[model samples]
Target: MPQRILIIEDNKDLAHLLELHLRDLSYDVTLSFEGPKGLAEAESVDYDLIILDLMLPGMDGLEVCRRLRKRPAYTPILMLTSKSSEVDRVQEKPTNGAP
Candidate 1:
């Protein structure tokens, strides 16, 4: 079976593009336009990977990632950022050296 990917991007256009691209690669894709809904979906289902964008409505990606980690969710997260600050923030590993 194809691996499933969840994309949580507030930008409608980017989310659509990602869905199309991943679909072409034969991966099952799910899209969410807001952070709350995205988090709910992520927690409720199993996905091989997640492409999450920072600066989302309702909640930021960092908080989302932290929450996921707290719940022991080990899904690989690829955080998308338009700001250099956001990129730098995500690149910083936790003090415990977790992914």
Candidate 2:
């Protein structure tokens, strides 16, 4: 089975770009524009990886990441954000097998 990837990006163009790139790489991709829906999907499905945008509506990506971590959901997460602080925050997390 293809590796499953979840993408939470509000920007339509960027989301489309990511989907296209991952599809070319032969990975199954799912997208959610809002934070609540994204969080719901995250809980419902088993994803190999997740690409989350920081400036999501309803819930911030940092909070989402923190929540997932609290649940001990160790699926690899790649945060896609415009904020410079996002990089700093990610560095604090233990990234194991993350691309």
Candidate 3:
């Protein structure tokens, strides 16, 4: 079966382009324009991967990722954001003896 992917991005053009490329790679892609809608879709279906935009209507990508992580079903998340600070925040990993 083809791998299922969820793309939550507000940019229509970018979302379409990403869908096209992922489809070419034999992935079943689902797109959402905003965070709330995306979060709803995520809860309803099982996706192997989630591509989330950091800046979104209703809720931000970080909140979405946090909520997803809290769920029993663990899905891999790839955050898309232009802000370097946001990337840094998301990419941070705990060091030894660090909170």
Candidate 4:
């Protein structure tokens, strides 16, 4: 069976494009434009992976992740963020000795 996936993204174009590409790769993909709806979809189905956008309507990806982590069953989550942040957030030491 194809691996099931759920994508929670507010960007319609990006989400649709991703769905198309994943489908071509033989993966089953489902999309939700908001955090709450995505959470509902996730609970209703057993997805192999979840592609979640950091910024969302109704709720943010951080909150969604927190809630999902509370569940007994484990489902891997892949979070995506378009916003740029400090390199330290990724826990990497700068090669140039910069913070």
Q: Estimate each model's TM-score.
A: 0.87, 0.83, 0.85, 0.86
Candidate 2 residue runs with Cα over 4 Å from true position: 85-99
Writing each residue's lDDT as its tens digit, candidate 2 over 1-99 gives 999999999998999999999999999999999888898899889899999998899998877787787675678788887767756656555434346
Superior by lDDT: candidate 3 or candidate 4: 3
Candidate models: Cα lDDT each: 0.87, 0.86, 0.89, 0.87
| Cα lDDT tens digits for candidate 3, 1-99 | 999999999999999999999999999999999999999999999999999998999998878887878788878888888777756666755222236
**Candidate with the greatest TM-score versus the true structure:** 1
Output the TM-score of candidate 4. 0.86
Q: Can you tell me which runs of candidate 1 are displaced by over 4 Å?
A: 85-92
Q: Please list the residue runs of candidate 4 whose C-alpha ends up more than 4 Å from where it truly belongs after superposition.
A: 87-99
Q: How close is candidate 1 to the true structure, as a TM-score?
A: 0.87
User: Can you give the lDDT of residue 10 in candidate 2?
Assistant: 95
Residue 64, model 1: Cα distance from true site in angstroms: 0.7
Rank order (by TM-score, best first): 1, 4, 3, 2
lDDT of 1 by residue, 1-99 (tens): 999999999999999998999999999999998888899999999899999997799998877777787776588899898887756766667632557
